[model samples]
Target: MKKKLYLLGVFILCVVTLSGCIPTSEKKSDTLGLESTDRYELLIGLNDVGTGKQIMDTQEAIEIIKMKLLRHVSGVTITVSNGYYYVGAFIVDEATLNCVIYGADDESIAAVVNEINSDMNVSVLVSKTPSKYRLITP
Candidate 1:
């Protein structure tokens, strides 16, 4: 009886100790080519309509846009200089009709794009690794 009890305890101990050593499959991230530490870079193109005229170049406009975008971007920060807006060290260039947004994960990126793209003027290509950016207005 004593020997059986001792063996049972040893087996239990071994099982407990080895359970952590066993390998388990890890879940894939929603973002392609994205590690837990990796962040996304979004190249933003702001346009008013199909005419290709870039508007809303003002502090108020920037504030409004930032407010709109803040929900999707985690810990967003904005700055103004050189006729451009900066979002967490990323650039918002209305002059060139292009901009940059940084530090978004895959879900957040989708949300951000969806919020801005109401009239199908925006399309996203997320199937690629490392991501791609193309904003077309028509």
Candidate 2:
């Protein structure tokens, strides 16, 4: 009887531990805000106006661009990376925008690009391609 009770207690402890490891259905559903059907990539390039041109801080610019992009598409994932433009032996800093836009159409993408161009001082280049992978937030 004592051995059976000990085994039962251990079994109950194991079941509770395993249950905690399992994710709730609500959490799984909340993983992504966008629909999985259609997605696109938007790559924006930023450059200075001229040799002596001044621009906003790199991080500030990235955040500003991200906020503007989010306004157009709420579920999009925006990632920013640093890039360099080589002018002869000189290297210049450039801000690169990598956005995974969910459920985006050509018209919506074009509109976002136009908005970015008008709001930012940096020259912008927009590229759109169907996304092959889903954007996951960490």
Query: Considering every candidate listed, which one attains the maximal TM-score?
Result: 2
Tens-digit lDDT track for model 2 on 1-138?
A: 999999999999999999999987764553446444456676666665553243676677778877787777766667878667787898876667777776667777777778876776455655555544455768
The lDDT for every candidate, in the order shown, is 0.53, 0.69
How many clashes show up per model? Answer: 0, 0
- The sequence of per-residue lDDT tens digits that candidate 1 reaches over residues 1-138 is 999999999999999989989997897555544333433433344445364445555554556556666777754444443335565877744532123454467787677667766632432233213434333458
The global Cα lDDT (0 to 1) of model 1 is 0.53
Alpha-carbon runs more than 4 Å astray in model 1:
1-36, 77-103, 119-138
The lowest-lDDT stretch of 10 consecutive residues in candidate 2 is: 27-36
